[model samples]
Target chain A: MSTQMLTYLFVGLSFALYVGIAIWSRASSTKDFYVAGGGVHPLVNGMATAADWMSAASFISMAGIISFIGRDGSVYLLGWTGGYVLLALLLAPYLRKFGRFTVPDFIGERYYSQTARIVAVICLIFVSFTYVAGQMRGVGIVFSRFLEVEVSTGVIIGMAVVFMYSVLGGMKGITYTQVAQYCVLIFAYMVPAIFISIMITDNPIPQLGFGSEVNDGSGLSVLQKLDGVLLDLGFSAYTEGSKSTIDVFAITAALMFGTAGLPHVLVRFFTVPKVSDARLSAGYALAFIAILYTTAPAVASFARLNLVDTVHNTAYADAPEWFGNWESTGLIAWQDKNNDGIMQYGAGAALSPIKPSFDGNTGVHGERLLSNQPTESTNEVYIDRDIMVLANPEIAGLPGWVIALVAAGGVAAALSTAAGLLLVISSAISHDLLKKTLLPKITEKQELLYARMAAAVAVCIAGLFGIYPPAFVAQVVAFAFGLAAASLFPALLLGIFSKRANKEGAIAGMLVGLVFTFTYIAYFKFVAPELNNTEHWLWGISPEGIGTIGMLLNFAIAISVSRVTAKPPQSVEELVDNIRIPSGAKAATEH
Target chain B: MNSDEHTKQASDVSQIDNQKNYWKANLKLLAKLLVVWFTVSFGCGIILADWLDQFSVFGFKLGFWFAQQGAIYVFVALIFVYARQMKLLDRQFGVGDENDADQESQS
Candidate 1:
């Protein structure tokens, strides 16, 4: 079949599977809606968490970013996965033992303050909204490229599909659908990588192929060859990093803490049957995620190598099919600056500044060959990073079926994460704000109704964000992690670890952290983009890295304030002791 | 009622010891696991990466592999180990039962 037909078929079938799971597992009660009735097996919950956690950024853009940036991209790989360690060790089991339906439930009950819970809810909504916008845009991008529809239309379709499952089945449907998505996404990601690995290096495993000798009888390792090529083109060595070590450290720390605090991911643990299961499930989630994370570096290296070899010094007329294909999508472009017919792509001018070789000789179409060269020209080819993964199969000359699978995988990634984030947004509004605070007398059935309605509303807003994304939306998504790390993680950790931490301390600390991180990100990302450079950053800490300092500030302030504040009530102390023991975690329905 | 009280009084000493031992053991285990976590993720993965890159493992620079793959593998192992060890600790303290454990205020 043709590529378009295959993509439609695979994507259609996956959507059908998700909707089918939703119909089969539709929830009848709030317990089922919120925590899948708290009966999911540890391994199953793990797979679902993996799917929910690995959003479009991880599945679609991560390898592409790594491909271009090379060694500097390790921050993402290490930071994203390393946070699970913190989650499993410090947070998951204890929170699961607390047996709450949402994160705010824990904060409210633990701090014995509705205000604290509201503060947490605000943070959750902000972070989840920022994240879901990216997912919606991702879905739109995939649809526009693969399905040949407008971005706005794609987002509406996406919203309709998500509404079907999430409103009907809530966490239960989203969980099972994510498991299916995990399978689809991982299979799609690995197949092309394996084929390309074998084709280029005679190594079947992409991970090993990344380091193996090239098959061109050059006897040089793949990394060695890539480094030589990139360095010759005035770029840094591909195997080594060019980022400041402090910035790398700070960015990695921010991501790790952020991952640990993300409300949607933490909610997955609430679905499992036991506290022990939560711990084991986290390990399982990481194991599942590592399958793709480990392969990503290999994909990055292979894509970079393939791109550089295929395009360097090739005439525009002789350029390969995939190059032209991506160019039609407007993701890749070329301009013959010197009228040399061949396109140049490098760091441009700083290393090998162009000299005017033109003698005013005109050729066909009034184009002068080598005579009108710009004195300082360097770059000629413009390649978008987002295209690398999407165009990988085409670049490698893989069959139409594999190319179709990549489209399905990208959609699955975006939809799964969007579903997860939407659930968190809905739950925060319905469970935290309306039911818990405004209408405590509301029935369970009524609360569930509110949750569904909230979900629909959230999806519509998210679609709007996707269609008309603000200028800073993409950059703001990065700060969602920073905000979570700065605001929520500190409060959650201190609430559990320090029994002396009171409502005043928790609320004060969260507000200070949230405001501090937000002001920093806003100032740099929107208010003063020019001042965002390393020279102007505080201690060379970019806004992405500023969260680390914000987190530290939260810890210090919370501890000092708690020292002077009134101690928690005796019942709250008992609650803390109870969570620490973790021997009597109740059913989700017990709430 | 007198016999019940007597049994409760008798078990309190042993129960206190069990609880203390369990809590102590849990914290100790967490400390050890956390040290390893910090060592692999921050130590070998970042601070000591260049130094460790002097050696190669399975056709990968030791530090680069740690930054990308090794830390994640160790993190998975550590969590499972912690879970298994915590289970034993809970059972040892006779606190593993769902209903009988931490029932002080719930009833």
Candidate 2:
């Protein structure tokens, strides 16, 4: 069968499975909609959480990012995984004991202020929308590539499928579907890794394969060979860091705290049966997540080495079909600047396209052969970072079925995360905003209707973003992490850990953190990008690392504010203590 | 009235004692686990990464391995350890399922 036929077969089968599961576990009430009726087993919830947490970024873009950036990419590897530690230890159990449906519900009741709840709802919406937009874009990219549809049409199809499951099943539907997604995605991710590892190093386990000697009989380890290849191409050593030490530390810290604070991931713990199960579920999620995280670097190393070997010094006329195929998608481009058919790619040429500058040779010269044309560089062959993972199987000459599986896996990862995020957005609007505050007298059935409607509306908006995303959307996604870390994490942690932290303090801390992180990112990323370098940075911290500093500011402000503010009411104090001791908890019910 | 006051005083003292001991144990456990978490992730992964890179374990630079894989493994282990420890603590403090509302309250 043709590759297109296989892709349709695999993608169609997965979609059928998801719809079937949604029908099997359709949610019946608000409780079911919010927390899967609080009946999910720990291991099952763990799998679902893994699927929900690992987005297209993890499945599709991570290895590609790592292959290019080298050791500096460890920020993503360490920062993303280490947050599970904080989640398991600091947040999951206590939140589960509180037995709430949404994150804003916790903040609303814990802080005893509707104003605080509204603030949280705003933060949750901003974070979830930014995140869901990226997921929708992933869905579009996979569909357009595999199913031969326009990117917008692909997004619409993806949004429709997600709408069917999420609106019908809510958290109940999303959970079981996510379990299935986790299986498909992990299988797809590992199969190519194993095959490539064997192809290069004669080892099946990618983790060990990454460290094993190359089959070329040079006695050099795979990483050593890869480093040599990269260095020859005028790139830094593949295993060495290019980022400054403090930036690495700050970005890692931001991601760690941000993952712990994301509302979508936090809400998953509420689906389990007990407080103890919440902690166990987090561990299980980490274990499941670790399987992919550990293998990604290996795959990255293999992909990088394979890619360099295949492309470098090869004649454009003799280049493989995958090159032309990707080139047609506009993901890979070539210029042949020096008029040589042989492509030269290196740090010197820089993958970014050169803008035609109009000044003289001393400044930004346009189309002028400057005196400093080092090494007769043609500067051809620019490849998009996003295409590396999707193109990996084809680059290695893997079978057609494996390529199809990758398409299915990318769809599954994006759909699952998008579903999880949309549910959070819907629940915040319907359950927290409408039922809890705006329309308290609304019945549970009405609230459920509102939740489904809200999800539909959110899907429409997310789909639109996917279709016509602002150029800044990708850059602003990281700010979502910073916002979560700076605003929500401090409030949630302080609410549980400190009995003296009053509503006044929590509110003040959240605003201060939010405003500080936002202004820093906005100024650096948008207003004055030229000034984003270390000379202009505060303490040499990039906007990406500014969240950690903001979090500290939150803690300091919260403590000081609470000292001067009135104490929390007696009942709120009791509530904090009750959340700590998880003995008398009950399943979440409609208000 | 006199008997009621005596009983109230006794229960209050014990309640305070339980709260104190429970919090103390919880704090100590969190401190120990956090130390391990921090040491592995930020310490070995970042601060000591250059130093540890000189040593290779199974062809991986030790620091690179920790940053990528080892820290995650330790994180998973730490959480399970914490869960097990917290469960025992809950049992010791008589705050496990013994005080839970009947199973019917659960879904």
Best by lDDT: 2
> In terms of docking quality, how is candidate 1 classified?
acceptable
Model 2 per-residue lDDT at A563: 94
lDDT of candidate 1 at residue A468, scale 0 to 100: 97
lDDT of each: 0.86, 0.88
Against the true structure, whose DockQ is highest? 2
- Give per-residue CA lDDT, model 2, range A151-246, as digits (tens): 999998888889899999999999999999999999999999999999999999998998999999899999899888888878899889988899
Candidate 1 per-residue C-alpha lDDT over A1-591 given as tens digits, one digit per residue, 9 for 90 to 100 = 789999999999999998999899898888888889888999999999999999999998999999999888888998899899899989998899898899999999999999999999999999999999999989988898888889899889888889999999999989999999999999999999999999889999987888788899989888888889999888898768777888888989999999999999999999987777888899999999988998898898889888887777888777777776665455666657666888678865412123323344544433333432343647776677888888998888899999999999999999999999999899888999999899999999999999999998998999999999987787788788889999999989987788899999899999999999999988988888888899999889989988888899888888899899899999998788778776667633276
Each model's total of backbone clashes? 1, 0
Cα displacement (angstroms), candidate 2, residue A424, comes to: 0.5
Measured against the true two-chain complex, the DockQ scores of the candidates, in the order shown, are 0.45, 0.58
- TM-score, cand. 1 vs. native: 0.93
lDDT of 1 by residue, B23-98 (tens): 6787798899989988998888888888998998876778888887788788888888988888788787766634
